[model samples]
Target: MRLDPPPTTPESEHRRRIGAVQEAMKREGFKLLIAYADCWRTANVRYFTDFRPVDGVHTIAQAVIALPAESDPTLFTGDGCLDYAASETAFDVAELEHLPLYLRRHLNADGRVALAGEEQIPVGLHRTIAEAIAPAPLVASNLLAKIKAVKSPWELEQLRHAAVLTDLGMEAVQQAVSTAGQVTERQLARAADVAMINAGADTPAYLSMVQAGPRSAFSLALPTNRVLERGDLVLTDIGARYGNYVADGGRGFVYGPPSGQAREIIDAAADAVEAGLAAARPGISAADLNGAIQAVLIERGYAEFSGEARGRGTGHGTGMDPEEELPWIGPTDHTVIEQGSVFTLKATINHPQVGGLRTERIVHLGATGLELLDTFPMRNFW
Candidate 1:
């Protein structure tokens, strides 16, 4: 629980990541790569330069890392953040306005330009870059995402610490639910947030979810002032962030002694998670892992509440971002699981009459098999 000198990604690792992206660009015939980041979606730029921009009402925080095929990469940010970016990032820092000039200097007439964060980039800036590098054709690229799917040793360590903090938060929620008289959902969520921060978390990975009774039927809901009652099914989904890496998981709990239907729903979700964990390995496809989980839910007569029925995946990759797109654990994703890949293995079942139940675990695929990063028990009835 005590990390005197917190673990961090060294400067050398950032250099190595830049090299990997450059190699990918080479293969894709990209002459220049523009990686963009904002306060919200920061993985692309932060992965390469290690500079997380700060956003404010007066100051719009945005960053771009321009990596040309032939020269060293440059990090560009707002004038307000130039000094901070220079101090934090390993690459050369420049003002945001210079990005067009940098692109003009490095880009050739015939070569194509690849953009890593096309969706998040502002339309005006995108048009400017497109005009600046006219005839070069800006194309969306998933090079960074593909590379980030696999975790390095250092990233795995950070994730492990994140998982520990997340578990502590969940433990605090359980204790609050059991001991507090007439506790509200908001209070439980506050308890979790305080516990994670006190346990050395940078912050909660996302807003803590505390849904009780029929409110739990929704897949995602923010904590409200609804008070707990006896025999009410409570669903809590919480996570913690440490060193910019995050761990996500959820569990089902009861305010008091559980009902027979509540017990059945919780057990089915936990069983599905177990099946998914057993089927997870290096060689399997994401679809196969999801199938294992789905099979359990269907066998338990919860077919209507399966992930496919709900039009959502069972889980997704978790790292620099809480929900990554790669290594997507669902029926449609065909990406192969690789060693050192970390993702959430979750089973969520929502019955119209019985309410909703979910159980999730942060798992890492190693050379041997899947390793569960979370240590908390799956079932909770208080």
Candidate 2:
């Protein structure tokens, strides 16, 4: 399938992001390497050469950009490169490009090299690369993962754009909840999802969640066509992906007349999320944030959480390619909050007798403290 039109990445900024990885590899002992990436299928290689593949809605897995220790990086992709890569990508590459041939042409055989990507790399390609390199076991190390986990200035800006789009999508969801006689669970899901896509999000991150009334009672939530009615509560867990970055959040809304009890649960969840965000900073551990929030829920006497919510951390890092990363912003997590990390703050409290209430937002670690990246309000939709 033909992907979306390419995005023009600033040449210098692209180089700088990769340069950080190059420097880190030098510190370790690998003389050469490849930063492999597939935006599902279209290999949007972002590196010194400035190629970021923008695939419209394809599920990418094997695509990757290989960067040698000292060479201009190139993309290795399937036949789609002829259509998408040549016209849209920042740097064009050979189609159905064999990694070994590309390596022989680009990298020296005798030098020590480190491989990229997760353990899921195709075994056939893995064997081929192993045979060519000298008999050194290029252990599975996540050099690129570590380097890219921290967002660059340009990356953060893209994330900001994504957050804005997602916020608007949530607003649409609020409107849908307010005007409908009774929202079918699936339709509510589509409303928020369509809102994101219409607002320039490349796609909704996933089938956004819509759990209604008792349906919201489950920790593992799914969207169904159940008609919501009065005294029914609705919770939507939603996110939008743009420019390869994403913004995810959740909010609850009342369908019919509100009950005093339902309002209390929504307020509690929102306050818990706020309490957690307030605790997030450079010095605090992930567990600290989780503890702060859970303390509120536990005090309110709703200790039970959706899917063992206490076990769920507030959130983790997000950036190009890698979906989630370090600083699991919840209790018992030791990941330290650091400058440059962007995380989502979410708290969903589930009650089997009633329903569930949740509030989520995006937050970044600032030089001074935690800065809220999301603007969506915490209250259940009006």
Candidate 3:
């Protein structure tokens, strides 16, 4: 069955978003905020004007959205006529060819301006905009990232729909792997990908991680043509995207019944994720939560298996991107977990004898407490 997302963010909510950013700019003394977006980081611009850049092949052309503290936001796209005709955008959109003229017209010579998506902006474009308003000085900031991390009601609903579709995809993969005596990893991945696409997702939320037996040791390994044995352990990491929001998490499975080591590692990872979930309420520091998760594994006598020893951290925020926006739940990050924040907590272990086992769950810090967004059962197999 296909699951659909709730109605997209309304025009009123878009106005509220613009107002919130303007308030933040006022406090920070920024006269204007210029945001950039490409196919990869489209959320930065989508937050202001519900417009996604056309997914062109072989090119990552950018679109710009300029939001002055006191004026209506204007969207500038290279394919101006196409986007203008296709997008039911709330604000005005003009050809990006006129960017230099627009910048010259609106920018104050000495006013402080901030740029969002600074890292994603191409070097040539940045230099052009930088040189256009030289004396004003373009300041690089993560203002939009911080603003977008907190989930609005509409965004939360979108995320929940995405997670439901992701669960459907995960279930399909689990069935594909468990029912087959010798299925290739690529075949299983294709099952999950096609399931999500059929369930109303724009695309697969992330690159599928489908590994069997020894290959599971690589946490982020891509799907391969390796055939799975009847008793092999299978690891599947998949998600789905709906209304620009992403769902992220995965589970492990055994082609048949799980072996002793496989069961033990999977149970230990579950214990760690459960511990993290209990401590995921608002006001906990990301570091403290990371510590809590690790403490469970250490208590279970897996002290030698430091998951973050690979240096990628246990988990991260999931929103516009599949990972890493805010409240980076790692060993050293001190970002305070806040209400309305949504993220994933993953626990993983790579053992010489047990291969790799991982369990992940998504959570939203509701007003009263934590809400589990994903409903998939954490079983060892279908």
Which of the numbered candidates is closest to the native, going by highest lDDT? 1
What's each prediction's clash count? 0, 13, 0
The 10 consecutive residues of candidate 1 with the worst lDDT sum are: 1-10
- lDDT at position 181, candidate 2: 69
Q: Give a tens-digit lDDT track for model 3, residues 1-382.
A: 8775446678888988899999999889998898988876677787876677766632225788889999898888765444542375888888776777888899889788899988888898888888877789899977777787788888888888888888888888877865776689899889988988888888887787888888877667898999987656677789888877888987877676777887777888888888888888768888888888877777776766646533356677787678746868888888788788889988877675567756888889887889999987665743
Candidate 3 ranges with C-alpha deviation above 4 Å: 57-60, 84-86, 298-311
Residues 253-361 of candidate 1 have per-residue lDDT tens digits of 8777888999998888888888888888879998888888877888888777666435377788888888875778888878788788899988887776667867989
Q: What is the lDDT, from 0 to 100, of the residue 129 in candidate 2?
A: 68
Distance from true location, Cα of 238 in model 3, Å? 0.7
Candidate 2, position 336, lDDT:
65
Task: Please give each candidate's TM-score.
Answer: 0.95, 0.84, 0.92
Q: What does each candidate score in C-alpha RMSD? A: 1.7, 4.3, 2.3
Report lDDT (Cα) of residue 277, candidate 2: 77
**Candidate 2 lDDT over residue span 1-382, tens digit each:** 1224325667677778667777877788776675455554221244334335445433223455666666556666566544555554455466534667766665555566777664546676667767656454455666765565567777788777777777878888778877886678898889888888877888876668888889988765779889887777777888877765777777787776778878888888888887887777777877877788777777776766543255666566665532454656656667666687887777777777788866878877877887777788787645
